[model samples]
Target: MQAVIMAGGKGSRLAALTKDEIPKPMAPFLGKPLLEWQLEQLKRYGIRRVTLVVGHLKEKIISHFGDGSTLGLELDYVEETAPLGTAGAFPLLLPKIESEHFLLLFGDIRFDIDLARMERFFLEKRAECLLFAHPNAHPYDSDLIVTDGENRVTGFDSKHNVRTGWQDNLVNAGIYILSRDMLRRVPEVKKTDFEKEILAPMAAAGEAIYAYRSPEYVKDVGTVDRIRAAEEEWRSGFPAKRNLEFPQRAVFLDRDGVINRYNGFVRTPEELELLPCAAEGLRQLNSSAYLAIVVSNQPVVARGETSEAELETIFNKMKTLLGREGAFVDDVFYCPHHPDSGFPGEVKELKIDCDCRKPKTGMLRRAAERYHLDLSACYLVGDTTGDIQCGKNAGVRTVLVKTGEAGRDGKYAVTPDLVADDLAAAATKILEEQ
Candidate 1:
C-alpha cells in the first residue's frame, strides 16, 4: 500500500526537542528519528512505499533516509519551497499517488494501530475518507468529530465553540485513509487545510466520509512532555498492546449503581450523575493495560420512557464527565430491549426477549469480537447479581461491588468471583492480581 505523510510542519511547538537543527519529523525519539519509527511501523503493516511531504530543513530528512533501502522501504520526497497547508502538497503529488485509496497522517503522531483492520473497514463502508477517531483524556480542548451510530461523519465541532450540553469524547486522532479521488478538491494546492477545506465540505455535502472509531494507541507526541510520555509508553509496550492485532483485556463495567448513582432509571442527561468512585476507578483502568468498556442494560429505551437519542445524551454526559477527570471509556455496549413489558408506553417491538440483556452474555460477546478480547482473561464489575451472572455466562471473572443493589436485587442467583466496596476497590483488586 502507498502512504503520504505530511512532514512539512516546522514543528514550532517542539522547538525545544528539535533545536531548530532538524525538522519536527526528524526529531529524535528513543535514539531514532520520529519519522523513522513511522516508516518502520508502516513497513510492519506491509506498506513499503511512502512519500514524505517535506519542508523546513528537508535536506536533513532526505539525507537520513535516502531511498529507505536500509529500512526495506521505497521512500520518496516532495519538497515544499514555501509554506503549504495540510492538503496543499497533494496537488503537487497528484502524479505520484497511484492507488485508489492511500493512507495519510501527520508526521508528529506516535501510533501503533491495526492498519489492516482500518483498511478493511474503509473498504467495507466504501468510504471516501476514513478517520481514526477515538475517545481522549481531554476532549474539552480538542477538536471533536461528530459521528452517528453508524460511524458516518455528521459534523465537526471546533474546540473554540462554547459547548454547553453533553458532548461525546470523540476526537480525530490525526490519522486517515483517503481515496485518491478526494485529492481533486486541492486544485492549485495553495495553503489549504484538509479538515476545514476539503473533508468538512465533503461531509456537509453528504459524502462517504466515515469515522472508524477504535481504542488503538494513536497520539500526537509533538511537544517535549508528550514525547517523554510516548517514550515511557513505548518502553512499557502499551501502544503495541492496544493495537487490535493483539488480544485485548478489558474490564466490563455496569453503568447504573456502578459508574453512576442508581436513581431508578436514568431517563435524561441531567438525571445521570457520576458516582464518587467512578472517575478515580476509571482513571486507574485508563492507565492500566485493561481497556475500560461499559456494558449496561438500559430498558428505558424499550419502555418508551426514553428514546435512543436521549439515552445517547445520557452516555455522552457520562463520557463528558469522565473526560473532565482525565478518564474515558474505550467503548460502550448497552441493551435497549426488555421482555414482558406492560408498562405505560412500552414499545411492543422492543419488548421481546433479547440476548443482549444482563445475564445473557451477548454484550460481552460483542465486545470480545470487536476488540479481539480473551473472555477468560477479562473481568466484569457491577453492583447486581444479574451482572455477575452475565460475567459467569461469558466465562469471565466477576467482581460484585457493595453499592446500589449490591446483589440484593435478587433478580438472578449467582456467585461473584470477588467482592469490592466500590468500583475503585474493584479496580485495585483486579490490578493487584494481574
Candidate 2:
C-alpha cells in the first residue's frame, strides 16, 4: 500500500537540534534520522511506496532518501513552495496515489504499529477515514478523541475546549488511513488542518470516521523531552518484543461486579444493567493506552441458567449501553466451566475443570497472545479475590475496587496493588501511575 509522510515541519520546538538547517524529521534519534526510523517501520509492514511532503530545507530530505532504492522503497516527493497545512499536501499528490486507500502519518513521530490489522479494521467498518488514537501523559492540553463502542469517531475536542470537564483522554496519534474520496472533502485552499478543518467538521456532519485504538508505541518527538522518551522506548525494545507483534498494555476488568451491577448471576439481557460510572470509567480506558478487556467467570452456562447465546446477548446489551456513553471494551472473555456436578438442569459436558476459569489465568494468557500484551506492564482492575489472583497469575499488576460483591471493607485471599472506591477511581489511579 502507498503511504504519505508529512515531513515539512521546521522543528521550531527543537531549535537547538535543528540549528544547522535540518528538518524536524531529519533530526537525529539514536544516530539515525527520525524519518529513517519511520520509513524502516513502514517498509517492515510491507508498505514500499512513499510520498514525502517537504517544505523548509526540503533539499536535505530529498538528498538523503532520493529515489529510496537504498531503503527498498519507491520514494516520491511533494515540495511545497509555500506553507500548506496538513491536509493541503493531499491535493498535490492526488494523482500519485492510485490505491483506494492510503496511509497518512506525521514525519516527526516514532511508532511501532500493525498497519495490516488497522487496515482490516478500516475496511471492515467501511469508513472514509480511520484515525489512530492513543492516550498520552499530557491529555489536559491535548486534542481528545471521542469514539463509540463500535470505534466510530463521534466527536473531536481540541485542547482549547476547556469547558468540557473530564472528557475521554484519547488523543489523535498523528496516524491515519483515508479513502481517496475523503480527500475530496479537503478544501482547495492553500492551507487546511486535517483535524480541525477537515475531520472535525465531517464527523460533526454525520460522516463515517472511525478510531483505531491501540497500545502500540506511537510517540511524537517534536519537543526535547518527547525525543528522549522516544529514544528510551526504542532502546528498551519493549515496543517490538510484546504480543501482537508489538508491546501492549491492558486493563483487565471483571464483568459482573465491576462492569455492571452484581445481581446474582445475570441470566438475561434485561437483567444486565451497567453500574453507576461504569461507562465513564470505560470511556477513560477507551481513550488511554490500556486495552480495556473484560475477563469474567460466567458459570451460569454450566449450570444451564444461561445459554451461551443468551450470554452473548447480555454482553451485546452491555456494549450498546456503553456505546451510548462513548465507552468501549477492546475484547471480552468469559469462563463458562464449572467443576461442581449434580445440580439440576446443569450441562453435564460443561461440568468439568477448565483452564479458562478465573484465578487460573487462562483467559488472561489467551488474551495476551491474541493482543500481544505485555503482562508485567499491564493492570487488572476488578472487585474480587479471584480477579486479583487471575491478574497476579498472569504476572500483571492488580487493583481491587470496592464495588459489587466486594464492599469497602471486604477482604480478599490475596492483596491487590491498590484499592479504590470504584472502577472510575481505579481508572484514575491507573492513569496517574502510568
Model 1 Cα displacement at 169 (Å)?
0.5
Candidate 2 structure quality by residue, lDDT tens digits, 258-376: 98998788998878889998988987886666788889899999999999878767886776567656777777788999999999999999999999987898999988876878899
Which candidate number would show the highest TM-score if scored against the true structure? 1
TM-score of 1: 0.98
lDDT agreement of model 1 with the native: 0.92
Give the Cα error of residue 360 in candidate 1, in Å. 0.6
Scored by CA lDDT, what does every candidate get? 0.92, 0.83
TM-score of each: 0.98, 0.69
Q: Lowest-scoring 10 consecutive residues by lDDT in candidate 2? A: 161-170
Error of 2 at 111 (Å): 0.7
Top-lDDT structure, candidate number? 1
Task: Give a tens-digit lDDT track for model 1, residues 1-434.
Answer: 69999898899989998889999998889999999889999999999889999999999999999998999999999999898888888887788889999999999999999999999999999999999999988999999988788889988999999998888899999999999887887999688899999888888888899999899999898899999999999998889899999999999999999999987999999899899999999999998999999999999999999999999899999999999998999999999999987788998899989999988988999999989999999999999999999999999999999977888998888889999999999999999988
Clashes of each: 0, 2
